[model samples]
Target: MPARSSSRLSPANSRIESMTVAACGGLATPAIETAIRIRLPASSASNTRFIKRSFEAVEPPLTLDEPGRMLMGMIVRPLRVYVSPVFRRIGLMLLAAVVTLASPALPAGGQDAPATPEVAVTDRVAPVWDGTYRRIRVPILMYHYVSPLPENADEYRRELTISPDTFRAHLEYLFFEGFTPISLYDLDEALLTGRELPAKPVVLTFDDGYIDHYTHVFPLLKQYGFTGTFFIITGRVDARDPNYVSWEQVGEMAAAGMDMEPHTKNHVSLQGRDYDFLVYEMLGSIESIKAHTGRQPHLFSYPVGQYDADTLAVARTLPIWRAVTTANGRYHTTDNRLEMPRVRITGGMSAPALASVLRGD
Candidate 1:
């Protein structure tokens, strides 16, 4: 493909060109004599000179030295030669085609290219960074399983899993206590732009993209008129793991205003990984989430809450705006965005316990 020219077509010219292109089917060569021509009335010399001067005043000069601007002359010259409407229309369309061919507006990648809209999710806005950071107390509650554990579940599973009842209690407390559930994207924007959040703003984030999130937590959140963010393991979804959320479920949640972000391709730790491995894991999950959600993820969750300097550097290089860790705290700042901390929601924790944790008691 030829390189696109840097010059921009004026809006008036662009509209005219577009209409002409539509009328002519974008064909450059046609039997001009056979084509319909509407003869324009002859203008007085004074009027013609005035019109020419007006055109010159509004339109920039075209020269061979600037190929990008040369196409304008082609369309303008036709108007001066004869008062035939067909010739002028054809010239306008040819100019449009020339400009389009010379500098296509389409991206280098085809239709399926990953596009990050201004807002990652609906009912949201892009964050504005004003070269400063603000400290705020917004508790980001992190969860794993919202379902009860099996008899054979090990200590690790026991530590992570929270019963559905306990999860409901947490939501109830949040709802009744006037805590507004927000996504990480909301927090990011609020902190960056000095935007005020609702009273008692709290973030609900689910890690690992578990099926329990879709089945148990999703409905409960909807019931309370709340929203949450889910960090997903793409490999598990791809492998059709019954325990993990399928791509269909992920899409459903994303469509319902859930903030779906990437954990990693295979839930790998970012602590000691090389650049190639980091890119593969990070981009793989990011692209997969983008494909399903139609919005590129701006947040990431570190597997096992482990990361080093390389992890932070790679995250900064990618589309990632902020990342959460297993570190315990509710006080978030713009300076520590990439290493934002969360309040770990442990198994068997009650609504009162959650309240206390949020209050830093």
Candidate 2:
């Protein structure tokens, strides 16, 4: 390749480059102001610099596409003058600048960055991000029981239970395909601090504290080295209900690093409940959970995915972080935190069906 031209950087381009550099270098605001005032008058980011140093930077034996693109870049550069972005957006602008600087010349396939070949790995979950989605799609997966159902089980039992074998396959598929399981707290912290989450994040949630959770789900979660959220019905806990788990099991799961959010005091639907009912369901659950687990529950799932507008309003009043609903869609950071949707996993959901769900299809 011939040496790049030594022409001076355009005043506009230079100012932009300087600002990007300054931001990355953690430069003082006064220096940036000095550059804006003295180094770059408002007029300088206009017509004169449009045939900017980018064109000059291009060597002469140009392709038919080069001049057109140069002209396009030059035109867009001036439009930045009219756009006054906030300071927070400056980091994003810096990223764009970095990309531009790093790959000034396109790769052989016309991509700015080299095309990475997909390498198959038996144990790795294949990454799926293509940088095209408008919103981050994370599937908050809901499960109830993960025990082997008998051949003569009832409809509700079958609908609410996933076979342990199928559950393990699901976990295997997730692990092989590279989905990172996270908790509601992780999502909350990310929303608050603008922290980046894994490219493919899937939250495993088991509703209604079942003995099967301690027997099958918890062990499977541990086997896969994954995390999950277990929603407990505080009234059923430690009451010797054969179906529901004990407080010792709940405490063990929490100590083992699983998230334990509240379901309700008695697992009642909150769709049209009064203020007193709502308080008992939400606050009562919190107090009961604290009494048993030594830590107050901070997140919740609506019992049977039932909640109305009034119930949601009451939920907002609770000290809990947020609540989840049974509506079937993926979770995005921008989605309503109070009414987040989840994909329910049930018996005999094939790997392909689960894959489609993960893909937000």
Candidate 3:
């Protein structure tokens, strides 16, 4: 077989040839002539000038006896004369054909077609509760404050509150959209068995044991039939500060199915603390939760999600099954439960944006 010519063909030219061939009933010669005439530049500067003039002249057409061949010859003669041999040998006719056929398929504005919608295709394909290896994991998200005020606000005056309307919209979206709020126990079981979570399984979590968690957020969660995890600062439980939730409020939330996990005795960063100090902070809070509510928490959320290898080591030594971290990224089964990642919800998170995050977008 003869080696194919290595001339590059433009999409535009290929389309033109296709259209010409279709119009001329699959005959190659006339299509080739039409392609060459359309693609090749006019011969000489004078010929170029004349061709431009001819188009502008707008004269009546002359009838020719040998219309087909004569018209083809007239159209292609200047192209053969003008185009350089290098371009001709490279099959400019092929290039022209591609262009013509492709032009009409393009939008009138010469833009590409709108992009196709993407379907989320995953390798894992099993029901979340099936206890199979192919199941996907659901992430439990946590939030502390959703204040519109800047972080630089005076520590005393800053509010840890999101507006009622925004909170309501968030709750409404979760309910209407069928997001099943699960417990930490459910999450652990899924991880252990490789079970898929519900299609829209998301756990809502709040930290700091804020009074607002009871007064403002709790009613909303209750109204929406959703459950959340609340990690309290053990030392601040009944402090005089109006911000901290009282023991009574914490008890109510726990009774209502919210997990009141430990966030350390003091809200101190435990990363660089000594072993003794770390143990006290970790164990003291766990004991406090048991003493106050009669429920020992197995989960511990790091204060500010700030912990080092030493802190992590201490966490592992303790009876805690999971230690939530401030790291960003969607969770997977292979992720370390002790250093489990949680998406931080804030005032800036819109419904669509939150949906995207929940969907692991």
Candidate 4:
């Protein structure tokens, strides 16, 4: 294509530009014109004097094939009009007009794409920094397979596979020590809304929807009256994978107060993938989980605890309120929701060792 003449009004940052949208849905030319017409101060003198030069230059009839065709040049090139001050805020207005004009004329979806509503520019929402609240010490304990590894399993399997007895010990120690196990959803709600958390709030998360979660993890959670978070590869559930949880078991666990979350449709690192694949992995998984469980999960666990900026952006674009990665630490309100960290529990870590990690030592 002709290098897609591109621009955008960073209404949030006070910048603007426009372009010929690629094939599909986008901000159409008329919509851009309308946004500019509405935002410009509606004085006739201002429109006649300042806004005319920029708008006349970009009003579509002579879309030059050359990319980056400067607006000043476009006006002067054909009509040979001397560019003069069009308004008091000519500089910012011109930049905005240019960016909006250069922005792809449709949403990437197609002409059928819904036009984005034009709203007054506003300041961006400042991030919730770590010091925004008294930071809570909530350790998100991450686990995978709870079954004992087969004899002579490799180191990766060995580290990921903690025995059922060890799992029980970890829960038992937590139960005795007055650690209240909360679901990821509960922690997320408290962290985001400043709600009260349990006295010793900690999260127990299982990845890959392994059957051990139903067999080994769920019963322990019920025994201790603890709520846990389970991240399932939606595609793997009820697939007769032999080691994964069935939809019926997953529903049962959710009924028992476990936070059921998407681990993506298939278990894979969702880094460096295209937008479609990201949509498939992120939105598709959410839909699949909702179809099975009837409730939409608010949290997602990055498959294998892996993600990138693109993946995080996609997670936020959807209904998922937050996401988790493999980085280990106690979560604070200021933590990045999508790239939030977790403390991994592996084979051979006794109850005392886990307590040390949880105590923020």
Candidate 5:
């Protein structure tokens, strides 16, 4: 007997035929023969109806001619007689391609994008400072005496004093914590050109020209290899004064790298004073310091941080470069050079507190 031909279809053969028709949009006799030879699985009649509806919605209607039209109709009639699963598979594949193309691109590293700069650990060791931002500022500390109190001297003790032990601890803390003691001249250079200071920078200043400042503080400063500024009251140097430093000591300090700037004649507040007295206080102190030390002091310290608009006006008129005030804050670029703020280091401040203040924390 001759070999019998199977009427039932298979899934694989149906998929191949459907893909060929979708790709070429036409069927020949050879294609139909090839599709029939590969046995395709039969799908449900409802599925065939759905696929036909979907195909008609997507594709333009075809017009038939004589021989090709007859062949196409015969092929589609068998496809409708036995439904095939190929159309559903093709739809799923096209849907997957669309979803993949529509999605957003992921980060190169296959993770969410970083929102901030990744600062390296090495950068933290030596921070590179650009001068654009006004974040950090130099701290200039002001002190007066280092003396233990006498039993019945409350008024004398409360003025401006720190014990020797406290002062030593403060210096040691600054030294160990990488602070470089800078002079007022160095500060002027930094202000003019935004230069990078040492890891830490601090300036030591003493006010009021007290005898104890020369007698006690100078020796300790010299021992520690540190320099400081001393603002002197010009008239009180040798005018029958037991409490103030003499002109001889002022000259000595000036010779030993310590600056001796003028702090007015009588240490009087310049706020409500007459213009003549202000001029006398301003110019007279400059003249007296020049006469004694042979070099005019270029800096000034306000008496008790008390100054008014007239005082600032007078300061602007003079050739003075900088002045110190007993203000309670860190020195910023916006600070007035004539009214520059100084952190007063007193008997109450500990080593850590002093360090914190110097670091502008």
Candidate 6:
């Protein structure tokens, strides 16, 4: 019944009141909203009896808790004989902000447990970056096929392909050894913005858009709660080749949070290509994957691990962030980001052997 306090509120609460007034189409001035808020004690127990009688002709649109309803009751009862319409509108807006920004309520029986706020994945990995470029040693395992070698397969294919059982063994080894799978984006973020990566970060990349990647690799990665980056050859997928993954399968993988990137349009080497040829191969595949998956591919796997100075120059001109190569080594730095190296996983390599390789033994 007394006048609201003339004291100033905290800067945050003042901003909230100002914004709420603006959002309500200026129907209620900041002073009015502030007045009602300053008067309502969160623990006030003037029941909903006053509100029901005051607005019997029209219902309040909000679904308020017991405390909020009580606070409304106290404010509404005083203004019912005066400007009922104006008070009703202003009361609703101020009450919503008060309840939201106020501290959590105690549970029944007055338990002391406060509701925990949900945290985002980015918040966990985001770092207070200092703007210093740094590098780290993280083995980026690369695979072509997770299937058995085809009959009479060439020596080149043998080096590129690893059997399904061997692939599963590699994942099991990594899991047991506490190797956390990360995307190239993760690596790039850490390099540029000082973002924190997992304790044991490792990158798993499957190149060339192979069909086995979707069939064998996808399910196994999901089974282990791991994610891999797949470098797609857009031309092969567009042609619907049985040996390559389809756009539908690519969509499904992208939706599942797998990193889908570009290899090239026709899987050609960019080492000696001209500017037009380079753009068509690199940017073309990038655009294709973006169209199919609704995510622009920032990471690129140079076709056949081939590139030259021209290639790097052109790649820099595009939106591509990091370009991986078949060269051996895991140490990644901002200086050589465009030519990040990978650890090749070949056939006939056991899980322990892969372990030894990753361990740098």
Cα-based TM-score, every candidate: 0.66, 0.61, 0.58, 0.63, 0.60, 0.64
Off-target runs (Cα >4 Å) in candidate 3 are: 1-135, 146-161
| lDDT (Cα, tens digit) per residue for candidate 3, span 88-132 | 323333332222222222122334433222222212122233334
The residue ranges of model 6 lying beyond 4 angstroms of the native Cα positions read 1-130
Q: Write the per-residue lDDT of candidate 5 for residues 1-361, one digit (tens) a residue.
A: 1122332333433332332221222111011122222233344333332221122212222223354445544444444343344353333233222221222222223343222221121101222333343423778898876666656757646656677788888888877788878877567656645566776788888888888888788887888888888888766663526788876688788778888888887688998664445655775576556545656567899998898776776565555777888887666552355667788876557898886777663
The number of the candidate with the highest TM-score is: 1
lDDT of each: 0.67, 0.61, 0.57, 0.59, 0.59, 0.66
Predicted structure with the largest lDDT when compared to the true one:
1
Per-residue alpha-carbon lDDT of candidate 4 for residues 229-277, written as tens digits (9 for 90 to 100): 8888766652346678876787788767677877876678887774445
The whole-model C-alpha lDDT of candidate 4 against the native structure comes to 0.59
- Tell me the deviation in Å of residue 249 in model 6: 0.5
Q: Residue 180: error of model 2 in Å?
A: 0.8
lDDT tens digits by residue: candidate 2, 128-220: 333332345678999987888878999998888878888889999999999899987777656544557886888999999999999999999
Candidate 4, residue 346: Cα displacement in angstroms equals 1.6
Candidate ranking (lDDT, best to worst): 1, 6, 2, 4, 5, 3
Poorest lDDT segment (10 consecutive residues) of candidate 3? 22-31
